[model samples]
Target: MTNPTNLTPSAFTGARRVATALAIGVLTGLAQAGALEVLVLDKEGKPVPDAVVIVVPSGLGVAKNPPPMAAVVNQEKMQFLPPVSVVALGAKVRFSNNDAWDHHVRLTAPGTAVSANPASAEGMSLRLEGKTAGKPAYSAVLTMDKPGATGAVLLGCFIHGSMSGHVYVADSPWTVKTEANGIAVLEDVPEGSATAKVWHAAQVVDKTPQTLVVGSTPAKLTLQLDVVPKRRRG
Candidate 1:
């Protein structure tokens, strides 16, 4: 072992240089990573929850928190428990009808106008029998494997026109659903330029994507939709 008091001047200087280099390296690594806090609002300036926020960095990057590969959407009280969901492309989505009455699951591509007869619509359709006492609710799993099926899928019921929901298949891994406060935080983003896109179920027209820069420091952005979202039933 080297004695501390007998250390030479040159040895002390070498040790100090190594320590400084290590500190600089750590800072450079941190500078390469960044974070963003996104807020979604309506035209009325009110927070819009359940909105999908996707961040695409200019450089090669991976999502620190990618969307789930599998999810379950339950039909309860004549409505989908989660009105909106975000999942990875080619994910498996399970639809379970927990209600006592039968319900039909109709899925259509985003931007497809609702047809007068939902059953006649062009998309995947299935029927789930009502749940019985002491038995598990009927569920059907559908894989979103269609080519170019990377956006929102409109969910509705043929028997109950009032029932509606959405399943968003994210093309990018850095996708998140805003919380009740209309906030979505994305971390571990590559520092540099990136595009941010927001999607809401109630928006008839898609909003334009916004460009922003990410640096060592955290950043915040606010995106507003053209229309206010309708409140979901209790």
Candidate 2:
């Protein structure tokens, strides 16, 4: 059992680090296995990868939750892997450090998304900032925590200001992180109008949730969004 004293402010920051580190590395395949095709496009009509698309039942048909899936935001050589991740709400996220040096992880409340490169209409990106509240829960080894308190969690290491990552926890279980090809497959959805929300750290969140129909023909959504240059993996 965790001691109450360890839950103090200073100790909380330490505990939070361990929590984030364990769940930071395993987001590449975290989307639900599906067949409804999800296509994302830039203003010029190119596939935009790394953009997460969420679908919630619009009462058109019954929607069921998949098995609980945990996620990771791992630290390695001072870089966060996958860079971006999508998860169902109330999902456990583990944060682990695999680097030779110790690192401090921090999170902020959800921020509104705005244009990062209004003229540059290509690439995957998001520039988010939230009103930070409370000290981070930290620990020595690896630790685990859920992204239940925030809309989107922005991660950065205090020790290494340059290192960063984004974890998007969706309110619904039906979410897909677009692949390199900018395709998110959502399957078994009830045919009719379902609400779809687009998430990008850099783009403005002015998009009105669009209605999507998951019928015999796959639903293809073309979103004209401003883009940022692609991210370089460390």
Candidate 3:
């Protein structure tokens, strides 16, 4: 290394310029991204959990946490373990029956009329046998590859009409599910304008998406559904 005391004036100026450029670059990168906090509420003004929140940035910003490409939904206590799930488009979802009794997995597009024969529905169908002692639970996997199946798909069991759930196939990587506090936090979102959309199982009709601006500072938004969702069974 060169002697510090013998450094020339030009050398010091060059070092200063390099340092300034690096500092500016870091600040610019930080300013280009931000975190968005979204809160979902029902028509009754109660915090809504399990809601799907999607942020479509105007600039092609990459998601720090993309939706999962695969997920598992379990059948337990005569109900789907997770009543709602958010997955990336073309995701493969596994349906596992943990109960001692057999269960059928019926998937159909939202707004599709319930058919007398669920097996004959337009979407896919599978029958999962009940789990047996000393053996793993019966499970089946289905790929949501259909082009038209980009949104929420209704999940049910023909044997048990009371069984209901949903699988939301997200088109954007910035999709997230609201937590128990009814908040969905999206990090590293590109700064600028973005369209925020909220989807709930109870909202049969889609709500209008809201437009907002994201900046270096954290941003908060609140979206409310038109209908109150029913509480899930414990």
TM-score for all models, in order of appearance: 0.83, 0.64, 0.83
Predicted candidate 2 versus true structure: per-residue lDDT over 1-234, tens digit per residue = 998876889888888887776555233222222246777776667777778777875533323543235677676666776677776555566666666556765654344331112232221232222212353323222112332332456667767898877777666667777788878777666565677877766665546778766565666665555765354564
When sorted by TM-score, best at the front, the candidate numbers are 3, 1, 2
Each model's lDDT comes to: 0.86, 0.59, 0.86
Report lDDT (Cα) of residue 202, candidate 1. 86
TM-score of 1: 0.83
Candidate 3 — which residues are off by over 4 angstroms?
A: 1-31, 112-121
What is the C-alpha lDDT profile of model 3 across 165-214, one tens digit per residue?
Answer: 88888888889999999999999888999999998888889899999999
Q: After superposing candidate 1, which stretches have Cα over 4 Å from the reference?
A: 1-31, 112-121
What local lDDT does model 2 show for residue 217?
67
TM-score, model 3 to reference: 0.83
